[model samples]
Target: MGETRREMKQSESLQASLPEDIALKIASFLPVGDLCALGSCSRFWREFCGSDVLWESLTRQRWPSLNFSTESSSVDHGDSSSLEGWRDLYVKWHAKMPEAMLVVQHVNQCAVSGSLDIRDFLKAIKHLNSMGLGFKDVEMFLLRPEVNVLLNLVGLHYCVHCLKVPAEHVMEALRNSKISQREVCVKWWNLGRLLFNGFGMRDESHCRLVSLQDLALPQDNQVLAVIHRGQFTRSFASRYPYSILLVLPGLSRSSQVCD
Candidate 1:
């Protein structure tokens, strides 16, 4: 009888020591909101979900379909007070992202085009910084001819777009350039009817070059839609399977991108 009890104890102990796969399987069925609950079960679970691959994969699984849109202005979009609502929602979503896969799910596998505003873009940068996330690639399509465009495009730092992503943000997150470790295909968004001349921007106003290294436009509209909507898919294929043309924004249209 004592031997039977000892064997049962050993069986339970072995289950406790099972490999990470079983634990991950259990975690997979959980909602993004409840991931932390699963992670709290054991140290292994915490490390498992915290990974970029795991979290990124989780993100693709949850928000399988997405749309990326912006309000044109206070009146067209909503009242000024709604800015607070936007900020609050962004903060809430950003906070929940770290807890699970919500943020990455929302951001990755996107081909952001059209005008993006600076203020909201900055908010996005703050969220990325908070969550330690990076983009696959970004292109800063210059749509306007205003001087604020320069200020707005200044934030075009980390990825492919030569616009308003903050260089300071990039320098601060120097180690954040995980993309460099891997080789990515050249990418360009819809540039038709848009004359962006920041490519030669070597003046004191511009610290970085606006040129593209392997800039190839997307040919397929499906992929462009993916980029257009800021939605990622489970399939991140190689060979630049997509070359597309779509309307996206410049760094100055910061409000559009960030909101």
Candidate 2:
């Protein structure tokens, strides 16, 4: 029985004595939450899991566009302590994401209600810019059908028109009110009348048509056209000098044009 007990101890010791490289390899595969939890097991693990290499990998994976460097000329040449700068940076940026998401959600809600204050919208844009995310990074959420419609109403057709504008220039334009909503609408009206007699709608499979009344446009504002879903026919195109055209497939031929 004593010999068996001794053999069991030897097996346990062999398992615990894995090479450092192999141990690190195994730990590297753990998710961030699991790794942080594992770190609480002991001092050895806390230092191992919090090492610069692992955290740098995590930070880079989370925010690929973020350019971060941990190298510092000011650090003592021979003082090699486990660097935790990357871990701290990752934690800081992770905490900031929730706040940024909330700001974006608030802006989306305001846009849907047609009560989007230009100043507030610009402020949100500026805030997101400060976080190092460009329009392309967040375009997936920003270019949703509902959000795109609101953007058009505000004269910022991000997907179609504002793709080439630099981020700084966009912020400056927003700050200076360079894009007037009324002027943009008028331009669309003129384009429809002169070129094709119809405003180009986004190539989406489905869209919910919003009326001027539903949008709560000011009473003084004049709507040049109201478009409905249907096939785009030559007669319908020529019927109105200016029209908002929706080209939806599999929909009925019924359409309406509001002068």
Candidate 3:
């Protein structure tokens, strides 16, 4: 028994002493479950398995559908440490639902067309909120251009159509508004040419559609400024018009239009 234990210890020591690059390369090809199980080995092996190089390989293997360039967000939060970037991506991948994916795709379509209808925005928000992301997490994620465009559309929708307040103050004002008032303003309104238009169906199809230009109140520049102030970064504002057309509504309505 003593001789057997000694040989086992020597084997482990030899395995541990292998050059780290070689060990990581061997680990990179492991199946996901087996790779995670390898963490139960030596401390060195565990750390090696956790490296971004390996996880990035794993992420690529698992979710070929994701936009690797865009899906990667910094998981490291200061000295607190975090999983490798690809591992963080992996976690989010499994957590997403089909409904959420559908809503997000719709939001992407809305962003491109600059034709965000309030009902669709609200549905996206509901799906996003169900994901249990904190307001701060959402804010941080918005730094990504794709994410920023989607949420900016929602934020703009809330600012212009949901609340009479300006974009910059939308979130703050939303917090203070009474629950009853919010319910009223946030409901899907069925605007008709007149009372004779008949009691319209109150379904998703009946939701009002508005563009960023139509909702840019007081002045187009001012609305854009307010949107910039809300949560968007300066770089995003510069790119917004070309991608989202927030400043050009293709409407002849008054610039002072308010909800």
Candidate 4:
């Protein structure tokens, strides 16, 4: 009789079932990549991926790069196969009710080695704007101008682990990146890395974000600007002589870019 009662309880629990709405809420918070993987887990996830909210979320995630369908033609992405792979993955997850990502990812740093034209710069921004996935795993190759725009749109509060580029490029990039945000922080910008050439002063908005951790900058005038403006102390500024330092006149000399 006890066994029968236990079996009845199990049967009742199975009959009640979990609600679809709860399942969807759980899936929405998962990263897009994870969703894509989960979409293949079984038929159940494929349906969840079809949700419009997910596509909207993905669209917001990859913006500017994948913001609109028309601008897509201009993207100088390498390898048609890769494009298809990303698309296929998108389709596998959200193809039923198509949407786009806010930023594009895996842009090759090697691609922007020689020239830093506005056309190229804009295209790079467009690319980053199209990345529909989260920024956690993807590595990007940005020109100085695009980097500025990236900082503005992605918000200075973003979680970035690295900011690599050449010395000259950082100067121009920092100059032009002064549009909308503040608080500067760069991480692991190598000594030899280069930035785009024609960057103007960035918006005042960059003043709020502060200090990059593990920053590796070149020793040059650009570094001086970043230092003088950022008000890096004599000790900190001495370390990075080449990379650009944005000015945040309000912060104390003791505050740091890496901390």
TM-score of each candidate structure, all chains considered together: 0.22, 0.43, 0.34, 0.32
Please, what are the lDDT tens digits per residue for candidate 1 over residues 79-174?
Answer: 555543322333343454443233223222233332232233334444444543333222111111221222112223323232223334433222
Q: Which portions of model 3 show Cα errors greater than 4 Å?
A: 1-5, 68-73, 76-78, 81-84, 97-259
Residue-pair clashes per prediction, in order, are 36, 0, 0, 73
Q: How close is candidate 2 to the true structure, as a TM-score?
A: 0.43
Leading candidate by lDDT = 3
Task: Report the C-alpha lDDT of model 3 over 47-122, residue by residue, as the tens digit.
Answer: 8877778887776654443466744654653534654466777666546533445555777776564434444556
**Model 1 lDDT on a 0 to 1 scale:** 0.34
Reference-based lDDT, residue 22, model 1: 79
Deviation in Å, model 3, residue 104 alpha carbon: 18
lDDT of 4 by residue, 231-251 (tens): 322212434432223444465
Lowest-scoring 10 consecutive residues by lDDT in candidate 2? Answer: 182-191
Q: What's the TM for model 4?
A: 0.32
Candidate 4 overall lDDT versus native: 0.39
Q: Highest TM-score: give the candidate number.
A: 2
Q: State the TM-score for model 3.
A: 0.34
Tell me the tens digit of each residue's lDDT in model 2 across 1-259.
9999898777656746877788688779988889999788656577778876787788776565556654422223255563336676667667666554655566666644333444444455555556654333343344223333434332233311223344344344433432222121111221233337566655322222343222223332233222211122121234332223332233342333212
Write down the lDDT that model 3 would get.
0.48
lDDT of each: 0.34, 0.46, 0.48, 0.39
